[model samples]
Target chain A: MSDTSKKEFKRSFSGYVEICENMPTGMITVRGDLNSRKLKSAFSKVVGATLPKERKVTLAENSIAWMSPDELLIICGYDNVSDLMKKLQKELDDQHHMLVNVSDARAVFEVSGAAMVEIIAKLAPVNVKTLEIGEIRRTHFSQVAAAFWLTSEQRMKLICFSSVADYMFDLLKTSAVVNSKVGEF
Target chain B: MLIFTCPYCGIEADETELTPGGEAHLKRFGPGSSDEEFEGYLFNRENPKGVHFERWRHVYGCGKWFHAARCTLTLEVFGTYSAQTFEPPEEIKERIRAKRPGWKWRNFS
Candidate 1:
C-alpha cells in the first residue's frame, strides 16, 4: 500500500468513549424585561422566587435565584426537567418572554465530596469559601463561561457549554484527584 | 475577597477579575472646589466596618462597574447594584435603617 493511502490522523487523546455513565444536567435560559413587576411575578410563579425562602419548589436544594435585568438562568434537578420547562412555557403564554431549553447542550457535574471546594478552586476562579450557601452564580470554568448553582452545604452543580463537555469532564476529574488530599478536609 | 454580581452577566465574579474604587457613581468636582473639600473628595476613603460600599469592575465579564457591600468581620455580601442604573434595593435600605439607628443616606450629587 502507498504511504498516501495508508495515512492516519494523529490522536490528540489516547482513547475515545461514546457514552459516559455521566448523565447531562438540565439547563434553561430565560429572557424578558426584568424591570417589569408583572414579568418578574410571572417568573416567580413559574420558577418560584429569586429567594428560596419565599417559594415552595426549590430549583436545587438550597439554591438561590440569581437574576439580572433581562435574563435568568435556572438550574434544577435533572429528573424534574420536562415538568419545569412546561411550567415556564405556560407561565409566559402570549407574553414577551422566551425560554430556551439547553438541558442537553450543557454538561452537569455534581461535586459533593468533603474536599469538593478545594477540587473546584483548582478549576475555577471564585473562592469556594467566599460563596455563601444558597448562592447561584454564572461564572467561568477554566476560561469557559459557566453557571454554578450552590445546591447544598457540600454539593455544587456546574453547567457549561456542551461542545466542550468532554474536555471539561476530563479536566475536572483529573484536577479533583490531584487536589483531593487524603485525610484532609 | 469581594464579589460583584454583574448587572449584565448575572454572575458573581471574583475579586481577582475586579478593581475596587471606594464608592460608585460619584460626580467629580472640577476646578470649582476648595483645597480641603477637594482633598476629602479626592483622597479620603470611608473605611466603615459594618457595611462599607465599594465600586468594582467586572474586567473579564461585562467590563462594567457596579456597587457592592460587605461586612468587614463576617464578609457577608448583602447585595449589588449597577453603576449606571443602580437603585439601591429596598431590602438594604430597610436593613440600614434598622441597624444604624440615626444614620441617613445624605446625597449631594
Candidate 2:
C-alpha cells in the first residue's frame, strides 16, 4: 500500500482514539471484572513495578483504588497512557482476567489545579467534598453520565460515554475556561 | 440531594444513584415454617441506639445492591457492605406482628 493510502486507512480505521481540543483529553475503557481478592492482587502486581515499594503504597504516592470491585477505572497522565495501558494489560493477562479494551467507549479529561471541585459542582450534582481522596463514583455532570476518579485534591479525572464525549468535553472546558478568565481579573 | 451511601459503590451518592428500598436488613421466612414462626421472622424490629444496618440500591452507579449501617440516635454511620456479604442478622430476621407494622412489599426479590 502507498503511504498516502495507508494514512487514509489509518485515520478511518482508528475507532478507539478520540481527542478533545480544549482540555487535550483522550479516553479508553478496559473491561474486566475482578472480585475483591483478585482486584487487590491484580492492582498490586500492576502497580508494583511503577512504584514497587511498601513506602509508596503507604503514602499513596502514585496509585490508589478509586472504586470498588468488578471495575477499577484507572486514571493516568495522557503522555503515560501507552506505558500505563501496556503494563495494565500485562498484569491482566498474567492473572488470566478477561480484559476488554473499551478505550473507545468513553471520553476522558483532566480537571486540575485548585478550585477544581468548585468548578465541577456547577455541573455535577453530588457533593464533591464527600468523595474521599482516591475514590471514584459514577455520576452525572450536567446531564452527562460520567465516571470520576480523583488522583489528588487538585486533579480529577472524568470519563463520559464515547457518543457524548465531544459534547461533555466542550461543555466542561468552556465553563471552566470562562471561570478561569473571570478569576484572572 | 439526600446523602445516601451505596454499599457497592463505596460512597454517598446524591440519592439519585440509589433506589431506597426502605429500611435495611429485614428478615423473611420460607413457606414450610409454622404460622407463628413465619410471623416472628416476617415482622419485628428493635428500636436501638447503636449500629443498625439498612439496605440500599446502587441503581444508577454500580447497579450492585447492598446494605448500610446507621445509628438510630446519633445518625452516625458505621459502614456499608454488600447485601450478599452475609445472612441478615437473627434479630431482624422474619416474624410478623398483628399490631402496627412496617410498609407492604409485593416482591422481596
Candidate 3:
C-alpha cells in the first residue's frame, strides 16, 4: 500500500492559460464487462450517473469517464469514495467485476483560459480546441499517459498517475508560459 | 511517424506511444516437443521484407494488445486486428494479397 499523504504538493503558473494542480478529485477504477446489464445497473445506481459511451465523459450527480473497452473511471466527491465503494461491492458481489478506490493514486489538474487548448496541444498530439463537451481522450502527454476532459470551452480537467504528477505539472507549466503560444495557423 | 489504430479502442496511435511485441501468432512448443521445435519457438523467426504480422500494445491509450499487418518495405500498415484472434483474419490477408499479388509470407500464401 502506498502512503497517499506523502509528497503532497500544489502549484500554479500564469500564462496564456492558468495551470493549477492538486485540485483533489476522487477517482474509482472499475473493471469488468461493460456490456453486462448487472454491471451497468449496479454502477449507475451507486455512482448516480449513466455509463459513458466509448471515449466519452458523462456529468450528472457524478461524472464517469470511459477509460477503455472494459474499464471506467468514476469521479465524485472525495469524501464519498469509501461509502460508494462499499455499496458497489455489495451490489456486484456475484458478478465478475472489480471496484477499487483509486482516489489516492492519481493527481488532478485544472487549466483555465480562452487559450486552454494551446497548452494541451503543446504536450499532446491532439486538438483539444475541438473536443466535444462529453468527449474524453486517453493519450500520451509528452512522455506519460494522461487523460483530459472538457468542463467547458475555457476550462478543463486533466488527470494522471500520482507518481508523475510533478512531471505532468512541470510539463504543463512549460507549455503555458506566455511566450510559448501556438498561435492560429 | 508510423501510426497504427488500436483495434480495441479505435485510437490512431503513433509509434512512440506503442510498444512493439515482435512477431505475432506463434505456436508454442511445450515440454513434449522435439528440440528443433523448441528451438524454433524460442529463437527462430521469419525476417520477411513484406506483409508481416506483428503484435503491439497500446501502452499510452486504451492499453490493449492488438496485431498489425504491415509492409516492411514501405512502412505501410494494412490494418490492425484484435490480439484475441488465433490467426490473421481473411479480409486483412486478402487486402495484402491485393496489393502484392501472390505474396507468400511463411505458411500463409
Candidate 4:
C-alpha cells in the first residue's frame, strides 16, 4: 500500500481537554434477530463477550455495543476485522444475519481531561454528569450524528461519520474555546 | 423540545435524537376502500388540541419507532410506548385517564 495514498489524520486541538484521533480501528456491524438464541450465542462467541443490553462491554482489546434492537457494533484491532467477520459468518451461517466491515466508514476520537464532559455537553444534549461508564449514547453532536461512550471518569470515545469528522472537530474546538473563556470569568 | 423514551432502548431521548413520524395508529385504507376512506387515510388528520397519540423514530438513538401520548395544547407528555402494536397499551391509556379525566383519543376513553 502506498503511504501517500493513505489519508493524513491529526487531532485538531488539545488543551484543558485533550483530543486525539484514535489509530485505525476495525468496526463491524452485526444485524440479526437479537432474540434468536443462535444469533446471540454466535455473536457472543465471536466477540468473546455476551451481547450487551442497553450498554457496551469492553474486553481487553475489543468492545461490543448495542446499536439498536437488532444491531450491534463491534470495535477491535484493525487487522482482526476480516478474520472476525469470517468467523461470525461461519458461526451464523444457519441463521439470518448481516455482517459488514465498516471500519473505514467512521472516525473515532478519544477525548479526555477535566473539561471533556463540558465540551461534549456543548455539542450534544447528553448530560455527561449522569452518563455512566460503559453506557453508550447515539445523538447529534452539533449538526452531525455521532455515538459516544465513556471509557473512564475523564475519558470518552466518540465515533462519527468520516465525512463529517472535520465538522465535528471544529465544533469541539469552538466549544472548548468558549468553555475556557467562561471558566476564566 | 419534547423528550420521549424509546421502549426498545429504554432511553429517554431528546427531540434532537428523534424524528417526528406524524400521527400514530392510522388504519390503512388500501384496495377496495371508498374514495372518502382513502382520502381520510391519506390526508385527513384529527390535529386535536387535547390528548394526542403520535409516532416518533429514535433516529439518532436506538433507531426504533415508538408511540408518544401527549397533549398538543400543553405539550405535556403523558407516556411513551412501543410502536409494534395497533393501539396504545392499556397501561398508557390508564395513565392518561388519571391525568386527564374523560380524555378520549380514538378508542381509549
Looking at model 3, the pairs that clash are none
Q: Residue A9 of candidate 1: its Cα lDDT? A: 20
Q: List model 2 lDDT by residue over A100-119, tens digit each.
A: 34445655666666666765
Per-residue lDDT of B1-109 in model 3, one digit per residue for the tens? Answer: 6799888887778897799999999999989999999999999988988889899999888999999999998999999999998789999999988999989877887
Per-model lDDT: 0.59, 0.53, 0.86, 0.83
TM-score of predicted chain B versus true chain B for each candidate:
0.74, 0.59, 0.96, 0.94
**Leading candidate by DockQ:** 4
Candidate 2 lDDT score at position A184? 26
If both were scored by lDDT, which would come out higher, candidate 2 or candidate 4? 4
TM-score of each: 0.52, 0.54, 0.93, 0.93
Give the best candidate by lDDT. Answer: 3
Q: Show where candidate 2 strays beyond 4 Å.
A: A1-65, A74-96, A131-133, A177-185, B19-56, B67-81, B85-109
Better of 1 and 4 by DockQ: 4
* Candidates' chain A TM-scores: 0.66, 0.56, 0.90, 0.89
Whole-model alpha-carbon lDDT for candidate 3: 0.86
Which ranking of candidates, highest TM-score first? 4, 3, 2, 1
Where does candidate 1 stray beyond 4 Å? A1-22, A44-67, A76-87, A178-185, B1-109
**Candidate 3 positional error at A48, Å:** 1.4
**Sort by lDDT, top down from the best:** 3, 4, 1, 2
